[model samples]
Target: MGFRFRDVLTSWAVPSLADLLLAALVVRPYLLPGGLDELLSDASVGMHIRTGDLIRSAGSLPHTDPFSFALPGKEWFAWEWLTELSLSLLHSWFGLAAIALAAVVLMTATSALVLRNSLRRGESAFLGLLLVMVGFQTSMNHALARPHLITWLFLALSVTIVERERRGPWRGFWLLIPLAALWANLHGGFAILPVYLAVVCTGLGLEAIWNRTSWRGVWRMVACGLAVGAATVVNPYGIGLHQHLIEFVSSPWAIQMIEEYHPPSPSLGEPFYWFAALGALAGLTAVSALRRRGVSDALVCLFFLISACKSARHIPLFVIAVTPIVAGELRWLWDVARRHGGRRSLVAIVHDMDLGLRPQFLRHSSWLPSLFLLALAFRGPLGLPSTFPEKSFPVEMVERNSATLQAGRVFSTDAWGDYLIYSGYPRQRVFIDGLQDYFGPALGNDYLEMLSGGPRTEELFRHWKFDTALVPVKQPLSRWLKARPEWRVVAETPLAVLLVKEH
Candidate 1:
């Protein structure tokens, strides 16, 4: 063993850690602290909590609750009613910090689970780190306090369970059934669960057929999956739940209103995600060719690759679900170097070469070591920014307007919805929230019209009956409002504008 070989290993180790750490740190900037969507979700949570209070006053879930966006004459999910109620109660007890802490905790725990699942399949810790880095990068765009967080966690857990045994543990699958019930109540995206489970079952079915294995395993998986699907109906909605989902999707408003439903624009804002997807696809193809192809592996890769390419937000799901499959496919590549006749000689040389290097120089834990590597990479292939903020929000404005905000309804952009909700100001009701489905096509058209300098903007405003409009200074609404005598600027800053109706 020589010092040179040890030096070589240390050099290799250092860059890998740095690459991951830099990715982690860089992705952190995308997280939303005060984005409009967060503000909306938070405000919705607050209102739902207040509505629950009113329900306690009026008795039973009121047929129509004003504090909630789920009013009559409107198509609504009320999916997050429980989460809102819970968050509202938490806000009452622990305040905004606690609610925010809850969001962070959910995100961190889900991230760790995804990482754990990735590592369980023989992936290097680096792969988990990379996947998390990519997840944060994608999810950060809409990092508001919303039910998607719960869905993301559930998806990760369900996928992990499905991987080990497609039948999934009976008890665990039943537990997930209830979680699905909760998820149905929490968010409309619970549909992903059924779809994911279907995919898993199909994978298992294919595996059974291909290997000529026992139908017992396949049948058990199919049965559990059907049971889980049935449990989704346990909610108050009954069969209306499925009907509601169908109607929601069929509605022109649903497709027109939601950004997530919109297909990806390769020309803007998602180059990295697209790059990763393309690379993963190419990598998967190479891996598939190198080994015996499995139907499930091919299907999973195709499914996620298509999904991610179709929408930017779907990137996190692809990264979470597809990365493991990619890694598994590439497992053969990891073995390639060992196949050559000189492999043993190379291994001996490498081992002997590292003998003299200090153990301190050979560190390889995770992102912590990756930090130094990131700094160097930033100047090269990584090309990440040198300094990244831990938070991606205008906290000063939030603190400054907290009291005023507590006194009124806020009309905000999609980005700041959850932040306002989490702020827990009782007087606050948001004009909109992340429940983009609730708004339907009409409101979305109106919003687009408004943002695009629509002439009927004022009429649309009167229609929604908004109290106060909080917008980024750059919005066309700011300019439009400033010219209108009916609206007065209440607060103005370089970053944002708060406008209130003139008395």
Candidate 2:
């Protein structure tokens, strides 16, 4: 088929208001003075970047934990090796700005895919865009410079591809195998791919059996699921990857103590606000209008919703899974409105808006690529920031008291341990970091007990023989240390304090 003028215009044009909005949302994070640096909220990025650097330096992935003092040489699974390598390369080439920009690009692309998939599933343009925006907004809470962002992008692509295959032939279903392989190297979340395939396949099989239709697609889906599952073991750790991830996820301490693993709470702020509102709307629509949408959509939505309820970190996954269903439900409402004269105020407003009308000039603007190139070219080196945000971390205190910190064994908060590894790794190793698996339940519980100043806190500290401590100013350990004659205050910042054992 030759490319027609209309086809060219549709392909090259600015497209719709939704496209413009998505572009804006993607670039907005990079507009601040720090650009992508502003989004580096979590200290985990430091460890990830450092891991990537180490991998590049050694020319192979490490099989043991090297960043922590608590468990040096313990077997470690660098499941996010690919993402770490990519981040390190970006940081080396364009500085942290590039790494941050990469994150924004991944998130925006995921949102764009969701929007496209919803429209492809017969949703109206406006409704699709609205639903995608909600999903994007809900995910903003966890949208830091981490491997999870890459996982989100792959998850969206996997779902779109699988859904397409479910609706049609199995021509592109095999693509999931290579995707699974790549995903396995990028993040441990690759395990979700096989589960997603299984759920969809089972749902389709049940539907076919109930309606007495051909089971050809169900068999194909089963084949695809097995292929993807096999691909997941293609990483450096091979079968060990699955075993490590299973242990981590199944850990009671990780599930209960980790903030991200905790259930979504309205008390937490914006993440919950959008999640609660959209979740209620989606649930109601699913019950009333989405019955005919098929069992697969219902199963996927319910699975993600329950997962999100169990852990707030899964909210974005839930948002991505439910967006198309919500869009389809809204499309049904729009059709009903159209049948009833389409004169409803809300319907009239959406209809009158020229969201689909592409202007002639914008149809061939095509300057975005060149503009982005120019921006990156002119964008000079990003001078490393002297300190992290004091509100979120103890950057100032760490820098001011670097000598004192390196003088002895130091015990710090889990988040602070991540920052220390990024800033002071060779000179200093941490008691604990974001790597909950490396520490396991014993050390993790010990660290938590010290932080909470439990009865065994003194005993744990004595066993570790930590002479220097860096903790939040308001934490129980910090407060208790302040009153102890054996520990003397050495340095203090607005958000953090440092103490040293009396000589």
Candidate 3:
């Protein structure tokens, strides 16, 4: 048989309507009124950029806290060094516009991979679209320009590969080795990779026992798990990264104090909405499990649902883990509905339209969807702001009062500290920032105490001997400092107030 154009087109997977919708949803955050820079809302991005600058300048990652005076020379792990380096390079070459565009591209690519995985599993186009829509809503809270975005993308890819391997030969298992290594350097989220592997392997082994079938891929899966575990330590910190990560995760401060670590609450409106939706979907899947369900799918969905409930940040992981399960369940539901009197329903309508499309048309038109996504990714850099949003950061205020800020030891909020470091580091080291691990339990508690104006707040002030403070105008600390006779307001803005100690 001779090679033909049709065969070539079919060999490369075509993007479906679901894939295009996912791409659009991923780019939605960047299309706000203020433009792409508005999507860079995470304060942590400032410190990430600063760290990237340091790595680029020194030609190596630093192992000591350099941005905060409170933890001067303290041992620190740049777990996100790779991500930081990328952010730094992009910001340096093309400014914040490039970073925003890069984030949109990464998120869109991640969504595309998830959509492709669902389609590859023989899920209906309607089911794929519904899953992507739900996944987007679930992950919107975490859609920021930070290293976590990198983790999300890698995790999606890793899960897709693992699922593929579970269904077929173990060819892609080896790829997880390097992916785990890269993940370790990019973010602490690398810890999830092993957990995912263990869960899948255990599910497969249990499934074999449940069905009284021979265990085919269990040994290979176990070996892949071992290899991935070994690959995780290939980062700069080696095993120390694991130690630090465990310490951070296990810390009471991290679990109780961090907003992201808290359980999903109704107080968080958008997040609560999606969390409830996922819970309802999980219930539906469980109720419909009798019709069609795999042990692995059920277990993974339960594990991720519990995780998402316990900590809001894990919502995206749950969204990713549950997509295929949701698609499978929805496919079953659609079939059931069609067999009943619901053939005239929306799902049936979509099913008819999808079935009517020719394979040749999809293969030949795949390039259009791919090109559309590429265009959406580039739209940010081409037409959006080149700098971070002024309202989000005290950019203009920092620049105008740079000399005054540099004149003294400054105490600033963790959120503001990142921006301060980004703009005025070396001359102005922070008391605290988003790198909670570097501060540890002791310093972290102290920072929180001072932030809440605890009884020891004065003691903290005396210990740090801070001569100036940059804080939000509406903060309690700012109000108290304004009332102190010993402190004078040197500069003030609607966003922040700069206070200096008076002689």
Question: Which candidate has the highest TM-score of all?
Answer: 3
Clashes of 2: 0
Model 1, 188: alpha-carbon shift in Å? 2.7
| TM-score for all models, in order of appearance | 0.71, 0.90, 0.91
lDDT for model 3, on a 0 to 1 scale? 0.77
Error of 1 at 334 (Å): 1.0
Global Cα RMSD, each model: 9.1, 3.4, 3.2
Candidate 1 yields a Cα-based lDDT of 0.59
lDDT for each residue of candidate 3 in 209-256, tens digit (9 for 90 to 100) = 877776778778888899999999998879988998888887877677
- Write down the TM-score for model 3: 0.91
Question: What is candidate 2's lDDT per residue for 205-321, written digit by digit as tens?
Answer: 877876788888899999889988998888888898898888889888877767888988876687688898788866776575436746666677777788888998899888877
**For candidate 1, lDDT tens digit of each residue in 1-503?**
69998877766655443334433444354343432224233333444555545444555454432433424445443445566567656656645444444555466556665665655552445444565556565555555455567777777877777666642444454566777777777666678777776775676687778778767766766776787788778776777778878877678776656666666664446546644655565456535833563666666666766776766557667666766666454445544643553646774444343333213222333444344434333433433221111143344666677876666656676545544654443444556655566666666677677665578988877777766777777888889888888888877878778888866
Which candidate would rank higher by TM-score, 1 or 2?
2
Decide which is better by TM-score, 2 or 3.
Answer: 3
Once all C-alphas are superposed, what RMSD does model 3 give against the true structure?
A: 3.2
